[model samples]
Target: MRLRILSADERLQEAQGKTTMALFGPSGAGKTTLLKTLPTEETVCLDLEAGLKSVQDWRGDSLPIRRFADAVDIACLIGGANPAAQPDEHFSEAHHAHLRAQHPELAARLDAKRIVFVDSITDLTRQAMAWAKTRPEALSERTGKPDTRGAYGLLAREVIGLLKHLQHAPGRTVIFVGILEKVVDDMNRVSWQPQMEGGKAARELPGIVDQVLTLSLFRQDTDQDGAVSWQHDAEKGHARRLVCQSGNPWGLPAKDRSGKLALTEPADLGALLTKINQTLKG
Candidate 1:
């Protein structure tokens, strides 16, 4: 290797910027439905939820869904680990190994112009927790009790490692679907965030990706003072909102490294990208 000088224009060509989106919301808020609308071409969704019911009746060609059976299944699919060394005779384990052999590109997803969707980190964390139950180190055999802290730590490490893989994969866009959980402060203020069990992943969701937004169904309501406040309405068929930047009255966790996005927008990536592009133009 040698030190090389490049013009500003030439340096720009080396940039492999990719969009990393973390979308979290309550169930039935259309989180998976929105993901169904993403471009189908070159897209592969890690279907942790195990079905396309969110977009079952929808029209366009549904993207390929890779249903993962467990946390190890996900790890194998993503080529994060080799499962051949694992015990044989287990159908799920063997299936994971077979799938990995079939889809080596998943490990190198960032090099393509594809999008990888990890549908619902909430479920992924659950799977991680389930894995902890199998380990005697994590669960004592004598007492038949599980180590809560150890289980949480494992979940955090698994999720953080997955996030890192997608974040560093330069050319491809990666989207993580998550469920929303609330935390109450001393003042009894309720704040919404990703539902990651056990450890600090709930707090680190925004920091691990290029963007983090919460999808919510909102309703238009007028206050006594004639001011309107958009409140969350779990009932669908109404207003759908995506919170991009944080510190809003809604108190949903969100952030974007690209500061061009509005604080909130409709639940569509096109809208967000348009706003960002328009800002860049200005």
Candidate 2:
């Protein structure tokens, strides 16, 4: 038997199966709410902040974390929920080992057209930091510094590495949900930006994801009678408008707001995903 090696061009051609998306917005921007509309089969959600449970009438199939070592251990690893323990208690190494042992199955499910959502990467970062804190030697250099560079770097590496690994799997969609934070402009003005609490991870995400979508709601000026006279664009013309972003991914900015993408009404997540998939196809 002869061994064949793929050239760089061939390798690049083989890397087209994965899609990475980042959903970022303010506290009530409906990020998680939008997720419920995605196709349910083979989809797994890793909720860190436990926000997914807040949906008033979300009736979808969900897999809960019981033991740390199930076939879907990544759910627990990235979900950011403590495994039935108090703040002082720690998740044991046995749990990690169990997860490692079953990683192959988890990877397989993801490769089988399964969608995984990590709700709020912030909590995962916190869990990683807490785990790192237990190992002083691994994070000794950052003992007193509030920068959290060392800790966050280690955390980012792990999370990004895992994401990359999942990306390589045959037919998986990995959706990462992140919180919005206020970033101070050079003029000391504050603007809402995707919250990347894990310092290095926050800085590194733009380069990792294929697309980063920021969701926000803007209040329009109203008349003295409190009637909304006109709706305003969330961001002035300089930046891309979500409603009118290139290709109208959400079908939101048509000539008249009568179609599926109408921005005047509440966001319809199913319609939004359909439009996004259509945009991706185009």
**Best-fitting candidate, scored by lDDT:** 1
Per residue, candidate 2 scores C-alpha lDDT tens digits across 119-237 of 76666666666654455435456454344455566566666655554444444456677777766778986555556546666666656665555565545576989886334444542
TM-score top scorer: 1
> Which whole-number lDDT from 0 to 100 does residue 11 have in model 2?
50
Which residue runs does candidate 1 get wrong by more than 4 Å? 1-17, 57-113, 139-145, 182-188, 219-237, 274-282
User: Ten residues in a row with the worst lDDT in model 2?
Assistant: 250-259
Error of 1 at 116 (Å): 1.3
Residue range 84-191, candidate 1, lDDT tens digits: 334552223565557657767654452243566777777777776677556665765567787776667766766666666556554556788888876789999877
Backbone clashes in model 2, listed as residue pairs: 251-261, 252-261
TM-score per candidate, chains pooled? 0.71, 0.60
Candidate 1 has a TM-score of 0.71
